[model samples]
Target: MNINKIKNSKNNFKLIVITAYDALFAKLFEKESHMILVGDSLNMSFAGKPDTLSATLDQMIYHTNAVCTGAPSAFVICDMPFGSYINKDEALRNCIEVYSKTQAAAVKIEGGEDRADIIKHLTSNSIAVMGHIGLMPQYVRSEGGYLVRGKTAEDIEQLVKDAKAIEAAGAFSIVLEGVKTQAAREVTQAVNIPVIGIGAGNVTDGQVLVWSDMLGFFEDFKPKFVKRYLMGGEAVRKAVKQYAQEVQNGIFPSKEEEY
Candidate 1:
């Protein structure tokens, strides 16, 4: 189904929008998801960058192309790199350049109230928009770290306003990430558009998790938001540890695998 149709399809169905970076994971997410976003969490999880803002436009386009090539039907979306879209005119131009790289169905940009104008400009021109709000990693420095948003009453009010503005600007969906469960639930209820949760909560219309977290890639820190589906890192570690032991014993190839 198309993006517009997806929202109308089921208000209660709860679509799954996953974060997949490469072709292999894209295929997996596409199989189980209604849509896939080539999120810039790659900077932290893949490139080993300290944060998301370090990701460059070229890197985002390159990985997004790979994902689009791998999953043709899942309405793939690429993330706009930091500083890629700011002013209305610059927003339009940068958005076009990214859309030209591959058949990515949309581009996700951070910010909410501040970016409403840009979102309107892009979506009005037929570029699908997925808005990111609450605990934006791209602003880690300004945020002083990845903390849960909307804790204070006034902050919650502001978040609600931001979410409503995003939907009014024609965003098909908004990501409510790393917020309190109550705030995430409130945001979901407040916005007409779909709310996709990361660390937000299960009450949202859809849920997205960085592929590495789902597949057990990160070793240093695990946020309370992500739930590991497969301990891939641990599995790999065990396999390699055993392999090392095998090599030392000269039993890896064994008798059967040998020609």
Candidate 2:
């Protein structure tokens, strides 16, 4: 989907967003999801890392390229990994590199009011941006942990301001993550752009979840927000076990199976 379609979907439709790290799932999600994010969460899900901080720009670009290759008609977003956009010039340079190296339709940056200027610079330079606020993973260490936001009136007000600022800075949309349901609804109303939520409730314009979490491939821990749609790991285990049993019994190569 393009920016206009995404913006128009704000009050009309519930946008579906899913994070994909490779071409296989990207293709599977393309027809159904409005957008596919090549998220830095890949560090945690794919590399078994503690957090997303260590994901680099090159890594993001590599995954973005794969997603784009798999879903040529899809709107793909590449995450601007932590430390890649510390300043306006650096942000612009890095974002430009992303545009040049991959087919990502936009870049998702984690921050809000504090990063408005950098967002403005990148947008002014013709780089599309999707703003991320509320419990930003990139700030997990500095913030002490992944905490829910918009619990109080003051917190809700700050969140509204952040949404407005990001929108004002030309972000086509925003991802409001790990927030109180009511507070997330308020933030979504305060902004003109679409607000995609995660652990932020169904009141927002849309919702996003990591593919593995939703599909039940990630069994280490289930977040409160994730609703497992399929027991992928269990199915895989069962299928493999059956195959092993058949092989051990010498039942795989019958006369009809001979080439």
**The best candidate in terms of lDDT:** 2
TM-score of each model, paired residue for residue: 0.94, 0.97
Backbone clashes in model 2: 0
Which pairs of residues have clashing backbones in candidate 1? none
Q: Assess candidate 2 and give its lDDT.
A: 0.94
Model 1: runs farther than 4 Å from truth?
Answer: 254-259
Q: After superposition, how far is residue 207 of candidate 2 from its true place, in Å?
A: 0.7
lDDT of 2 by residue, 10-123 (tens): 789999999999999999999999999999999998989989999999999999999999999999999999999999999999999999999899999999899999999999
